[model samples]
Target chain A: MRGLFKKRRLLMVVTALSMLVLAACGNSNNNSNPSASPSESSAAPATETASASASESAPIEKITLKALMHSSWLKGGMEAVLKDAVEKTGITLEIEKLPEGTDGDNLIKTRFATNDKPDLLFFYPAVKESDGLGKPEEQFVPQDDQPWMANFNKDVWIDAFASSGTFYAAPYGGSSMAVMIYNKKVFESLNLQIPTTMEEFWALSEAVSKAGKVPVYLSAKDAWTLQIPSLQSGAAQDNLQEITDNAYTNKGTMSDFTAKRQGITFLKDVVDKGYVNKDFLSDTYDNAQKALANGDAAMYPMATWVMTDISTKFPDQVNDIGSFLIPFNDTGKNMAGIFPPSAMYVVKGSKQEAAQKFVNYFESIETQNIYFGSEGGIPTIKGITNTQLTSAELDAQKLADEGKAGPVGVSPSSGIPQYVAGDYPAYLQDVVAGAKTPEQVQEAEQKELVKNAKAKDDPNFK
Target chain B: MLKRQYYRYSMLAPGFCIFLVFFVWPAVSNFFYAFTNLDATFKYTRLVGFDNFISIFEDSGSSIAFKNTFIFTVVTTISKVGLGFLLANFVNIKLRSTNFLRSALFFPVILSPIAVALAFTAIFHPSRGFLNVLLQSVHLDFLMQHWLTNRHIIMYSISFVETWKWTGLTVILFLAALQTIPKELTEAAKIDGATSWEQKRHIIFPLILPVVNTNIIISLIGGLKVFDIVYALTGGGPGNASNVINTMVYKSFSQGRNGEATAASLLLFVFILVLVSITNKYLNKDNRG
Candidate 1:
């Protein structure tokens, strides 16, 4: 009986060892497929382009470039552009979608850390350096010599993506500005004009509140939306970049910048005055859009992306939405804060060429029109006019033409810590909850800025 | 004889290899990472000793997470085990629909945590939630509360959801253990002039002490490692009111502070180990007595 048991155990051990070897082989095969396919496909495209030159009539293999995009970006006419690229260039894009916000940002970093980088990825290059990918110069393929780069709008690319005169990313879509989108019907009902100064804005708020409607819909629950009032405050500061730079380099504090400081103060003021929704803490950006569309709220201080979202959801109410720059100061000189579009970056990978080709086709005038038609905004490329521009777009563009607009928000390129921009809304939430005063928020922010700067090994912080 | 012994040990080789690779390797690397300043942005990694741990301890965010985690674990653990026992007893009573009732109770456990949290988000909406509407309709207006938004009650609210989803598991476990109790023993007690409550107190409770102890440990571990529910529901928001250690670790990792995030995770591991160990020791003593 003992020998029979031992024989059975020997047979089981041999079977287990064989199964383990098979599993190992299967895993190794699975691991190589992703990295191998990209290179194999990338090689085909290059040779096809070369062979087509040698023989005029030849078929090109459709190359699929892997890309990582936030799930929200698909709504911004990115899918149309992807389909257009495939139709025109025969280069397919296999996109891996991730959740947006902090969750998405961390996943992108993890991908890079694990050396599982996609051919292309979406990120705002202005703040890309301090983010997980490290310095953009080392991480991305420079697009300085690309034909599309020359046709791109110089001001935006230089201000937003270019660091030390080098471009690493191309704008995926047009620019958006942080502006106050108001319901024209609500304004007409209240008999209020578009406010151009802080005093007039407060007057309009009181008027709307008297009518028993929310004057301003503050979506503090989303947290990121809380930064709009403060970001809009940057419009009135002529030396906004300078002030941010000083704070970035540890030479000045956030409280030293008065205009931006007032933005958080305005959030608290609106809540205290009962001008915002009663459930501001519970309200989300989606809920804010509904309130604005239904004329339950007068104004929502948000980026122009809400226009696309609102118009898509409520087409009839689209015409009733009008926008103006946030009059955050009493001086009546508020410029609309210009926000750069989320750009497509070429990660240093085996499929850079195909990614560049897709970017080129995506920037062409015909494809851009499709993007702007569906998701209306200012085209970042030169000589491409969007005929279907919304009233909000025209108003923001008018501010830009009059030299009243400047860059808004702190970016890593400006020497500020990345988390200051990423987590500022959390502090604003505390401010909204009355857990921290604006001054206290600034003090806490300053301390965080120093700690992060030191972590990054910035000499000035030491 | 030597060859037979070798064959016996070789049977464990594959299983041991998988455990070593998947669990042990990552745990060991995480331990090493906790002692370094390794982050997403840094190209080179260097050791910073206990600075990551010290930083986590000093941060206000970590303190909030620790407090919230404590409340969440305790509330969920007690509620799940206690409610599970009652439900198990109720279902164990010979009924025609016992099998159907068991399936209905376990249904919530199979649903996705994210889906459940999202459905609960709408159900807990301040002005429009079904819970509040039902309360108002029943004329219990004073009992209606902001189920998700109130910072003070957010953890408890989340704990309620956790308990609701997982209590069925405990019920199933306790039910299985209860079935093993011989009918003869309970019948003898009944014949000796004992009431149902008396029989339960003397027979069922003592017999199922082991299951109850197991349920507590399972619930305790599950409560500590919770991430998806809290993340999907609140994202640790309305100003970090519902932040737990895992969510805090996620935020730190999001901010590229991998070292601090790993240190926080290590602390959580140690916390779970100590709590489970103490509970194990106490429960074993009870079982022995």
Candidate 2:
């Protein structure tokens, strides 16, 4: 009986080992097949023939590239537009729409880790920063430091993105930073003008509250949204990039001490004064968006994308939607900032020649126009213009032109460390809940910055 | 007889093989990965000597998550077990319409957690929610505080939802255990001139101790690994007030800190193992006594 039991245990162990090996093999198989798709593999033969003819001249071969991109990029049949462009150039294209969260990042990471990378990778700035070093500076570095980083204009950094030096992905769509979307009917009903100053904004919020409507519909449940007004406060607003840079590099004189205090104060005041729903923190982004659509709240701080999203989501109420930049310092400037150029990069170990050709084709003015026209993305190419933009888009452009716009100070994952983004939201939410003072929030933020700096500097620390 | 046993074992081999492949192997691999610096970016990783385990203690997020997880587990376990037992006893009494009452009690268990959480969110809404509206109707306006956002109250709010969802399962388990108790013991206690409460204390309670122990272990284990309901509801925030071990692991992994996330998972596994073992030993001893 003892011998029989021992034999059975050995069999169990063998079966377990075999299963693991099989599972690993199965994963590897799944990874490789998609890269070696029929169209892409077929293009390889024509490229080899072209290479043979130009042994002395190294001719650039016409090759197709497969790209994994975000669903946002594939809006309004943009993939089909790209497909048509690729066909015209004798280059085949295969694009896969990625799902949200770690699934997309993991898919890309898995491909790279397994040496089965795509020809062109559509890198989302959000996912890159999400998983990396917690600071914004470290988050901005492009994956593999691709060559296209050098071609982008540095001055656009003030309008769109944080870093002036590094470019990983090319910027596509430009969004207004920290704009408040108010119901036009509510403004008309209350006889209130669009408030441009901090004091006026608060007064307006108060009046809206007194009128028995939720003053601001903040989806505080997703902590990120709660920090928008606080992080964009007059003080933090004055030297947004500088503070972000300082926080990342652990250098530079911090500025806007009062502004940071005021920002936190405003957030706290809004919550304490009953301008926001008490259950705001428990609400989802979708719920908050729906609330705005249903006219449940007078205003919500969102990006320019909300205009397009609102128009698409609620066509009937789209006419009532209007936006103005959140008056963080009462500057009366309608433009907050521009996100850095979104672009594609070729992985390091990729078949470089084909990848480069694809990149050149993708960045061409014609391709840019197609992408812009299809997705309403602002093309990065110098001369490309989008003619079919909505009224909100036109207003946003005017704001950018008037020097009212600024770059995204910190992204969730990539441009700066998340501790900056992550901690600020909670502090603001506490202020809303009447738990913390604005001064306390600012002090706490500075302490967190110091803590993050210590952690980044210490290699021994996690 | 030996040949027949061998044939029966051979027939079970296919299922055993599948179990080994899907569950046993991955679990063993997860155990191994916990000891390495196996990040998402790197293909090859070196075996780091307890660095991940050491970090778990040092990180504030992990510590908070551990404490929150323990609190949630202990609170939910005791409430569900104790309340469920009382409920079960009441429902198990002779009744003309027992089946309908039992079904009504078990209804919450059948509802999807997301649906239940959404319903509760509506109920807990400060200005417009059902709970506050009811409070105001009854002239208790002072009690209406922000239920989901308040850090002090959020944990309990989450626990209430969990208890609401799971109390039914506990009740049913107890009811089943109650039915198995020999009627002779209860009758003997009654004949000895014991009161209803006394009879329950000595006879029914002692008889159901094993079942109570089993329910407590199950509920405690389930509570320790609670993820979906909390994830759908609080998402561990208004700050990190409601964050549990699984949510922390998710956030860490989402942030691309795979090594840290694995470490958190490993620590949670170790905690569950120790907790379940202690409970098992204590229960066995209690039953014997």
Candidate 3:
């Protein structure tokens, strides 16, 4: 009886295995069909045939490439644009979208360590040269070969990534621009105009406070949010070109960039004057967003991405939202500062032709307009218009075109420390929070920077 | 008999192999990584000897993080175990709606750490949060402050969240232990005119010591590795006021300072290992006695 039962079970297992194999085969067949309609398939084959002919005519054979991207960005539909471009170029792309936090970086690292490196890797634009392997000369190709980085100032973008005159990554999309998003209803109710200068900003903040409303919803608890506005305003106020140049040349100290100190002072003044809530430092991003949306606070310095979040959270107030560049000194620049490009890097050991083609396609104006517009991001490529821009984005774009605005790269305090070990942002937060003076913070940061520089030079030590 | 024994060993082999590969290998690698310069690139790894460790020693932030981590671990561990034991004792007794009370208590433990942190963040907000609003309504505004950002109170605030989340587990464990205690011993003590306090001290406490030790060790290990709550709550911010070891390690890793992160993690592991060993020795001695 036992043997009979076992035979029956064996038969069942074989049937299941056959079904699994059949299912696998079915999936592959479905994947190859690509088109939903017969007409679409018939139309697609002509393009595919032409592409194949072009490939055959070319002396160089096309190579397959793989890329890893963040899942959130992919969910926003940017992956389709990339895939379309790759398919057109006859490059087979194996794209993997990873979750946020350590998982993303860990997956990339694991793949790289196992000699299965992706052809292209999406990296935070702010990743410092020193954070990577050896000097870029020993790790990657020259910047001239990678043309996309040419838009940003060489000192800030190319040279920043270039160690010994080689570039590892091409700058792609920019981070969401930082600006003061205020409720238009609140402004009309308070009979206030948008502040145009730092002094005016403070005065307006005081007026808002006197009116019994939170002037600025600063979440110092989540320090990054607090730092963004400060950094933006500071960049607008400071001669970052000169500062960056000097820092790059090793002729100037990071302390020479005093606008950051001014930024912190502005935050401190806001806190001290009771313009912001007492619990501002303890508030999370969500809490601050809620406070702003629910009318607990009048204004907040947040990225353009907040527009979508606000619209989703408070559909009624979507039209009532207004944005302005965070003004610095009375410089009269309407644009606060543009976010530096978030970059896509080609791995050093990747097939160069395939990686270059992918990057080139990614940087093409059409691709930028299509992908960036759909994803609600400003395209880095100039002269491409995104018809899908919201009113706020259009305003920002107009401001950028009028030369009233400029693209400000990532803050040195955040970016540089990624390569070197130092608590630049944390120290600045302390200064803003009344824990440390600007001078004290600057001195501490300088010491750490010098120590890190020395550590980098220490060949015998490692 | 020999074949049966072989089958038993084979059955256990898969689980043991999994443990070795996933847990043991990573733990061992983390220890080795402490001595290398394995930054974000991971490709640029080089042996840096004790440079990362030396740097950690020199950095004031690291010292503060170490101090905060120890304080958080000790405070949260003790409070969680104590509160959990008390609640367990109360809930374990025969009562109407005991199951409901138990379920309610265990509910927070089942919640995602980030979600709990977010909920607590709202409750603890100084101006608009429910806690402060209640305080204001009761004319106790003076008592309310920025709970998560105030340097003086941030540690306690973080510890409170940890206590809130894990206290239920401790309570359940203690309740299970409490149930197994001899009814006869308590009855005898009561017959001899022992008060509740005296009986608890002599009979109940002694009987539950083993469970207490186990809870302490588990909570200690958990407390030592506390990351998500802090990450989602304050992110060890407002100038490293609430920086813990795990957050520090995370920051290092994010910034591509893999060597420093590994070193910090290794230090944390050693700290936990030493703590566990000490607790184990004490428990074993007590058992022998």
Give the top-scoring candidate (lDDT): 1
lDDT of 2: 0.65
DockQ, per model, reads: 0.53, 0.35, 0.37
- Candidate 2 lDDT over A69-161, as tens digits, reads 766555652564567655554466677778644446667666655556665667644334324422224222342243433444545442333
Q: Write the per-residue lDDT of candidate 1 for residues B91-181, one digit (tens) a residue.
A: 9988999989999989999999999999998899877889889999999999888888788799999999999999999999999999999
Alpha-carbon lDDT, every model: 0.81, 0.65, 0.69
Minimum summed lDDT over a 10-residue window in model 3 chain A is located at: A32-41
Error of 1 at A317 (Å): 1.5
lDDT score for residue A111 of model 1: 80
Encode model 1's per-residue lDDT on A67-91: one tens digit a residue: 8888878775776776777666778
Regions more than 4 Å wrong, model 1? A1-42, A49-56, A410-422, B41-44
Candidate 3 segments exceeding 4 Å error = A1-120, A126-198, A233-252, A284-299, A302-327, A331-335, A345-378, A388-418, A421-425, A458-462, B1-29, B43-49, B134-142, B279-289
Model 2, span B187-246: residue lDDT tens = 888888999999888888888999999999999888999888887776676666778999
Report model 3's interface C-alpha RMSD after superposition on the true interface residues: 5.8
Per-residue lDDT value at B186 in model 2: 83
- The deviation in Å at residue A312 for candidate 3 is 6.3
List the pairs of residues colliding in candidate 3. A221-A281
User: Could you arrange the candidates by TM-score from highest to lowest?
Assistant: 1, 3, 2
lDDT per residue for candidate 3 within A263-298, as digits (tens), equals: 666666776777887666666677777777777788
TM-score of chain A of 1: 0.90
**Clashing pairs for predicted structure model 1, backbone only:** none
